[model samples]
Target: MAKLDLRGVRKSYGTVEVIKGIDLTVDHGEFCVFVGPSGCGKSTLLRMIAGLESITGGEVAIGEEVVNAIPAADRGLAMVFQSYALYPHMTVRQNLSFGLENIQTPKPQIREKVEAVAKMLQIDMLLDRRPKDLSGGQRQRVAIGRAVVREPNIFLFDEPLSNLDAELRVDMRGEIAALHKRLGNTMVYVTHDQVEAMTMADKIAVLRLGELEQFGRPLDLFNNPANLFVAGFIGSPKMNFLQGRTDADDRNRLILDTGDTIDLPEGRFTQAPGQTVTLGLRPTELQPDPDGALHAHVGAVEQLGSESYLYGTFQNETPVTVHNPGQTTIRPGDKVALTAKSTAMHLFDTETGLTLRG
Candidate 1:
């Protein structure tokens, strides 16, 4: 296993800069995920690490060796693509063994490696089947097996599970996680799905518009985002933001545009009074109460058996969502009051979008 490192890494096309200067490191045996929206440069960054894209500036290193000028094949890394890029004419075993054969590995060695990977991926039975005869999930397993047979220093996955159906995706996720446990190699994964990043990554790198927004443990980004963008992007239902201005009389109070007032804990506001700020509250943090600080008019309700999500607009018509336990009797057009503890609130400077802490 090898640790991957990027120092001032950048990629540009003429005047269009896709990847600004970035510095990151992936420790040996670590499962790191790059997650962001489309065109956020997560894929571009992965390609740069794979040596498939030329770096405009800076160093890409594997372990202690710089590999910015090294060819992809010589980088000693294995990649699993989003598309199951299996040769249609080759059987599963053949596809898995083809790479090894290209390197002129001995026939017996190739067979042993293929058998081991096939069994580990639970695709041993499908070895004789061609890609045309295999299911989507099976084809994906074959693609991963192809990578595993390489025994590279690091494994890179570029949205490998994006093509499968929801159920299949979930199953493959478990399988991939299990594979990582069994083979303990450094892994770098890129995906647009925050859910996948949250569930699969030992650490998550959140990106936006070619810039690294935040990189840390999943729960760190979830509970304590560095900025408004990170806070708004990491959670499932997404954190709700309310426009408000700091109260002049009390530094620990904010007056919302909806005409409601939310009390913050003593000495919570570091920004000056009268400064516009945003109050962020996660869906699960808000609770229904008779006498609550905020009020909303429910517009829609989504019941998913175990929990229900209430979607609505606040008094100011700003969209808000609330998570309720089990089923809720609340219906569309129902006006409800919601309350949350001051400790659960997140304050951000409206202008800079940076968190404002006490």
Candidate 2:
């Protein structure tokens, strides 16, 4: 196992920079995930760590050794890609042992390693099958097995489960998480899926454009986002935003565009009266109340067995969503009042898109 570190890491295509200065560290045996939207430089950052991309300026170290000049082959890291880059002609066992053979490993050691990895990944029965004959999930396991036999200091995965079906993806996620526990090797994964990052990572690095937005544990980013972008991007179904202004009569009160007023403790906000701000509320935070602060005109309902999600608009036509546990009888065109505790609310500055702590 090894620790991975990046300091002022950067990359650029001529004048257009893709990765601005980024500094992060992945502790030994830690599962670190780089998560962001498409074209957000997550993959580019991963490649730089893998030594597949040249670093424009900065340092990348593995186990206290700076490897900015090291070749990918000599970096002592194995990578599993989204494409399941398996040799079609080789059988599963052969594919797993091919890398060992290239380095002239003893035949007996190669066989032993292949057998162990195959069994560990539960792909022992498919050893004789070719990539063309294996299912997508099976092929992915084989690709991962190929990397495992290498016994590298670090493991890097680039959207390795994106190709699988929804059911298979969930199954593979568990398998991968188990594999991490068993091997206890430092792993760095890059994906656009927030769910994967939230579920698998010991720590998540949220990226946007070319900058690192926030880096912390999943729940930390979820409960207390540093900026508006992190708050909106971290949660599923996303957090809802309402435009409002500080009340002239009371600085601690905010008046929503819909004419609803929310009272806060004295000196809760530093913003003066009439200053525009945004109130962020998660779907789960909003509940149906007879005298709720906000009223919604339901537009759609999504029933998912154990839970239901209501999509609607406020009196000012501002869109909102509410997550209701279990079955919901609420239907389209129904008017409902929603309320949330002030403790569950998040406030942001309208001009800077930054969180307002006080």
Candidate 3:
């Protein structure tokens, strides 16, 4: 396995720059995922690494060598595309053996490699089936198997599970994570889904509009986001941002435009008296309370067996979501007060969206 390094990597379509200078590294055996919303340059960055797209500037290093000039075929990287790009006419076994055959590998060697990869991917029983006859999930396994049979230094997956149904997507996610575990090869995955990145990546690079917003462990980005964009994008149900300003009279209170005042923790937030600040509250951290300090109007309620999610809006009609454990009697149109879990509040500068810490 080889580590991958990207130094000031950039790509542009004529005068339009898509990839801003991005410096990231995926160590040997590390699973790094590029996660962002669509059109955020995640796919463009992946193609740059694969040598499929020319770099506007900067360098790409696989292991110790700069591969900026290397052809994609010689890069020793196996890629699994979102479309499950398999030859429709070829059976599973034939498809798995195609890459090795193109390299003129011995017939016996190709047979052995295909058999091993098929079994590893649990597609051994489906070897005789053509892509036309296989399910979406099965076809995905074959595409992955084709990559595995080649045994490249690194694996690149471009939204490999996007076409699957919800249940199959979850199943395939586990399978891919397990494949990475057993093979221990460096992997770079591109997905717009933050949940997938959180579950599978050793490191995550969060991108926005071609800029690398933040790069770190999944939890690191979740717990202490570098900026408001990362905070809002990394979590499910998403973090709620309420526009407010630090109260000049009460240093520990944040006065919201919605006519609510949220208490700030002592020694944890800076003094930005009277200046507009963004208050971030996680849904999971907000709980219903009778005498809670903040008020919200419930709009909708989602009952997920073990837990409940409530969608609401504050007095100013700013949307907010709250995750409460177990079922709740709270219904739509109900007004509720919420108490934030201790130290769960996030404060950001209103203008810059940068986190405010003591």
Candidate 4:
């Protein structure tokens, strides 16, 4: 296991800068996940660390050595690409042994390494089967096993489960997490799926348009997002944002665009009156309240077995989503009252799109 450090790292494609200066640290054996939407530069950053992409500036260090100019093969890191990248004509055993063979590892040591990794990955029975004979998940395991045989100081995965079916994706996700626990190897995984990052990472680094937005534990980023973008990006079903205008002084409150007043606790707004702002409320935080003051017209309801998501608009057509237990009979055009606690609310400066508190 090795600690990884990125200091003022950057990358560019000619005049277009894709990765701005980013500084990050991964402790020994820590599973760090880089997550963001498409075009967010997560993969670019990962490839830079693996030495596959030349760093335009700054430095990358693994353990205690600077590896900015090191070749990918000599960096002691193995990357599992999104495509699996297995040799179609080679058996799982041959694929696992290929890297060792390339470096002229002893024949006995190569065989021993292949057997040990195959057994550890529980693919011992499929060792002789070529890539074409394996299922997608099995092929992915073979790719991972190939990495394992290298005994790399660090492992990098780039959306390795994106091609699999939903069920297979879940299964493979568990396998990856378990593999990390069993091997205790330092790993960096890049994914656009927030759920995968939430479940698998010891720490998550969120990036947007070449900038590091937030870095923290999964739940910490979910619970207390540093800004509006991080808030909207980290959670499933996403958070709802309502445009509002600050109404008064001494006591702060936002009058929703729908002409409904959302009362805030004292001192909630430090911005000037009439300042445009956004009020953020998570779906789970918005619930049906029989006697609540706020009412909305239902637009649609989606039942996902365990829970329901209700989408609707206020009388003024301001959109909102309400999370409900089980399934809901609330159909389109139905009028319903909903309420949310002030503690569940998040405030943001509309102009800057930055969170505002204290």
Best lDDT among the predictions, by candidate number: 3
How do the predictions measure up, each by TM-score?
A: 0.98, 0.97, 0.98, 0.96
Winner of 2 and 3 under lDDT: 3
Report the C-alpha lDDT of model 3 over 89-149, residue by residue, as the tens digit: 9999999999999999999999999999999889999999999999999999999999999
Model 1, 1-358: lDDT tens per residue?
4989989989999999999988888999999999999999999999999999999999999999999999999999999999988999989989999999999999999999999999999999999999999999999999999999999999999999999999999999989888999999999999988999999999999999889999999999998888999999999989999988988877678899998998887776587878899999999999989899899999999999999999999988999999999998899989999998788789999999998876
Candidate 3, poorest ten consecutive residues by summed lDDT: 266-275
In the range 1-358, model 2's lDDT, one tens digit per residue, is: 4999999999999999999999999999999999999999999999999999999999999998999999999999999999999999999999999999999999999999999999999999999999999999999999999999999999999999999999999999999999999999999999999999999999999999989999999999999898899999999989999989988877678899977887755554467777888888999999989898788899999999899999999889999989999989999989999887777788889999888866
Per-residue alpha-carbon lDDT of model 4 for 185-225, expressed as tens digits? 99999999999999999999999999999998999998888
Worst 10 residues of 2 by lDDT: 263-272
In candidate 4, how many Å is residue 180 off? 0.6
Q: Lowest lDDT 10-mer window, candidate 4?
A: 264-273
Give the Cα error of residue 79 in candidate 3, in Å: 0.3
- What lDDT would each prediction earn against the true structure? 0.92, 0.92, 0.93, 0.90
**What 10-residue stretch in candidate 1 is worst by lDDT?**
264-273
Better of 3 and 4 by TM-score: 3
> In model 2, which residue pairs have backbone atoms overlapping below 3 Å?
none
> CA shift at 45, candidate 4, in angstroms?
0.9
Give the C-alpha lDDT of model 4. Answer: 0.90
Model 1 spans > 4 angstroms off? none
